[model samples]
Target chain A: MDYLVTHSPALIVALPLLAAFAIPLISRLGPRVRAVLCLAVLGLVAALVAILAVDVHAVGIRLYTFGATAPEMALPGGYMVPVRIMFEVDGMSIFMGIVITTVAVASLIYSLQFLNGQTGQARFYSLMMLLYVGMMGLAFTGDMFNMFVFLEIASIAGTGLAAYRTNMADAVEGGFKYIVISAVSALMVLLAIGILYAQYNVLSIAALAHYMQYTTLDMMALGLLAGAFVMKLAGVPLHMWAPDTYTVAPAGTTPMILAASYTSMYALYRITFTLYGGHIDTAAIGWIVIIVGVLSMFVGVMMAVHQTDIKRMMAYHAISQGGYMLLGVGVGLAVIADPVALANYGRDAMNGGIFHIINHVFYKAMLFMTAEAIFFRVGTRDTNKMGGLARNMKWTAIFYAIGALAISGIPPFNGFASKLLIYQTVLSFNPVLSVIAMFVSLVTLASFAKVFYSAFTGPEMPGYKEVREVPKSMLIGMGILAACIILFGIFPGLIVDTIVAPATEALINQAPYINAVMGAAP
Target chain B: MSALSYEAYAVWVPIVWVAALVVIGVIVLAWRNRGQKSYKKGTAQTDIFLSGIKVPPEEQRHVKAENVYWGFFEALKGFYSVLMRPHTGVVNDYILWFVALVAVAILILVLGA
Candidate 1:
């Protein structure tokens, strides 16, 4: 128990990676054995993440160094530089870990029945586990180059999964586009890493932060990292791939893909807050993020209203919801220099943004699952052709309604809690931004209302009268997320106090993070 | 000061609105029924308004999903036109947009520096 608790950071990532490799061999046992193996692996990963979260909150940051005598012994004898790779498990990393693991377990369970009897089950399970490994590594790694490596692993796994349905031309096309964009953006990230390495001769993020001078090369690298990550997160203008990819990917995989996108968003936050803290022009970068966010919100929602395909519309909403996070955090960044403002509103804005990330993982996953349930029964995603499904699929309708209400920011759901915080804080920072956020929420509601009325309500269509409800396992998968949406909505305070506050403090206080890895940071 | 004080922000407002709507609906129903002795089922009173044009039963039951927000769409036609044009669903166009945004980001960062 002691060893597991102590070295769990490395184990959490390594266990799944090893399991992923063993899956193909396990497939010879049969589909049922492979399915159980996938679930057990993800389930253990979820347990480890929960324990890590509890441990992180109880203790301080946990740093595990590879190929070294001690965790902090990054330097060799008589050497003045650190070359060892380390994983730093802070409050933020643990929080993201919990989100990823929860979604992974639920999606994998859902896929058990959702992708049952499909060909390439072994390959699918392997790719799913590898994807989890990438996200976990990216979240916990304290090294910059390692972050890139993990990112490429995730991108490749994700591209393979996105293109998994090889029969459909659109699925292939979407996968090709996704890989192209991901590969290009990753190259840019590598270029930025190379630039940083060239100048500082160090790849450790903490070491780089300690010696940051905000020089010309550092500025260029910052721009490149920021651009690549924002594109990866599908911020508008760069969001065209999202609708295409989301529309064609297997229903169970869409939520995982969404989680991958959040990992990129996490990278953006980590880079700006910890890697470049107090070294750059906060106001300038804040404005840049705010502009991109505003554009994403407006453009994403406006485009969604015109979409007839259910998944495509939800993809647009994903971009729009991402905008809220950006807007809230950007407001915090914009006012970081003003202590008065930071205390007054910036803290709340940051909390809202971070909280929304967790809230989004639940409700959006539920929404996509419901969309998948519809597709499972109706064999189509076009809303124009769907109608009166609620008559047959009672649980799915109820679940879809809950998800729709939660996402639209109606009260007593998690979205309302987070969006309300964002609204109040952004209102304090700039009334115009608050108003825009509210307008975007309204449009989101209107668009979802269209989805509900079209897909679930009205008279029974001619062919759908005989349609039966989806399988039980699929409902269970969606139920977990629905329960979370309700739980987080009612107890936002508890969640904030326990997880979000510590995560926020970890983001704000950069000195300790650097000190943990660099031995007091001189 | 509390970042998560949701209750302090009138969390019951949605419930209250829902209750008020239910009460108003009941009162309206009572007032409108004051002079009526009885009502017939599926007669002229229950018939859906179709601008006084007679329609077949199948056509009468048909409701178009896209037409639900006709008025709203009409009001935002110009905005919709601009927003819809760029969603070309073409891969090259998507890549172009990403590249353009990267250029814009670099330009801004350099200028800020």
Candidate 2:
């Protein structure tokens, strides 16, 4: 037990990575053996993350160093600055861990049947495992260079998965676009990392935070990192690749890819709140984040409201949902310097923002799966070509309704719980932005309602008369997320008090993070 | 499972609200059950009437997704036009927008500092 707790972080990233490489070789045994192996590997990783979450919560931040005499020896005895790579499992990292593991396991279950009889099954499973490893590493890594390395691993694996259907032109095009966008943004992030390393002479995020002076060089690096992550996260003008990539991604992978985008959001927060906390211009940077978020919200929804393709519409809404997260956290960042305001509303705003990330992941992923379920059974993503699916695909319809209501912030769903937090706290900070957010919620509802009517409730279309409920594995996959939505909605306070509060505290307070790596100032 | 409150400014007790909605739903159902006893299914009473003209077929009766919000689309055409200008689906244009954002962010961070 002690050994497991001590080495869980490394195991979480390493286990999946090792299995990802071994999958192709394992496939020679048999498909059944390979499938069992994949599930067992993912299940073990999820268990490890849960254990890590508990340990981190009970013992504050936990750091495990690679190539050290001891796992906890971030700084060796004789060295002034630490030289080893490390995994920092703070509350925020564990929180993201919970999100990624839950989504990955469920998505894998969904894919079990969604990709049945497809060619290259072994390679598909391998790429999926690699994607999971990349996301886990991104959330846990303490070193900036490792973060970039993990980001590339995720982007490349995701590109391969996005183009998994090589026969389709759109699939290949989507993959091409994603790799192009990812390569450029990753290059920028690398440049920023280089700039920081040249000046600060450290790769550890904790060390950089301890030494960040907000010089012009630091500002330039910050700008590059911010741009790259925002683009990666699909925030507005940089979001063009998302609709295409998301719409063309194979079933089950769509939600996983979306989770990758949220990981990018996590990186953005890490850089802004942790890396350059005290010396930065809080109000200016805060408003900049807020503006990008607002634009993303408005433009994403407006575009979604007009999309004819079901997947494309959902992709736009994903961008819009991301904006809410940025808005809430940006408001918090803007007021971090003012103790009075920070105490009054900024903390809650951050809570709302951070809470929304998990909530959005669950509901958005389920919604995308439902869209894919429709495509799987009816052979069309065009809403115009669908009608009265509820008559046959009852489970899919119910799941879609749950996801739509939750995402639209209707009563008694998780989306309302998180959005309420944002609306109330943001109203205190800025009423106009709050109003715009509420309006966006309403627009989101209208858009989903249109899709529901066109796809599920209308007169039975001739083409879809034989459509049926998705496979049991797929239903089980969506059922997990839907259950989370309901549970979260019913117990919003419990979730916020336990999971979100620690993460919110972790992000807002930089001293604890820095002190964990470098002992508290003499 | 209890109420979620935010510093006394707002409270959301979803369980209570859901219960109330259920009760109201029961009352509405009771009220609905007490009316229209004379109406018969599969009779002339069920025939559709639109401005005293012939009703459209079931297929035509259902609205297509694209036409669901025609009025909103017409009213907001200008807003959408300006918004859609940047979404040209070109890779170069996408990169350009990202570059512009980086430049603007650097200026803000430097000047603001």
Estimate the Cα RMSD of every predicted model relative to the unseen true structure.
3.0, 1.9
Tens digits of per-residue lDDT for model 2, A1-522: 999999999999999999999999999998889889989999998889888898998899999999898898888887757679999989899999999999999899999989889899999999999999999999999999999999999999999999999999999999998999899999999999999999989999999998888899999999999999999999987899999999999878888899999999999999998998887878988998999899889999999999999999999999999999999999999999998888888888888999999999999999999999999999889998788889999999999999999999998899998999899889999999999999999999999999999999977877777787899999999999999999998888889888888998888888888888887334
Q: Residue A36 in model 1: shift from native, Å?
A: 1.4
- Poorest 10 consecutive residues by lDDT, candidate 1 chain A: A72-81
Candidate 1 residues lying further than 4 Å off, grouped into runs, are A76-78, A520-522, B1-4, B7-52, B58-60
lDDT for A308 (candidate 1): 86
Best by DockQ: 2
**Docking quality class, candidate 1:** acceptable
**Per-residue lDDT tens digits of candidate 1, residues A423-460?**
99999999999999999999999999998988888778
lDDT of 1 by residue, B33-62 (tens): 796667788788867677878755642364
- The global C-alpha lDDT for each of the candidates, from Candidate 1 onward, is 0.86, 0.91
Give candidate 2's root-mean-square deviation (CA, Å). Answer: 1.9
Worst 10 residues of 2 chain A by lDDT: A513-522
The chain B TM-scores of all candidates, as shown, are 0.60, 0.80
Overall local distance difference test of candidate 2 = 0.91
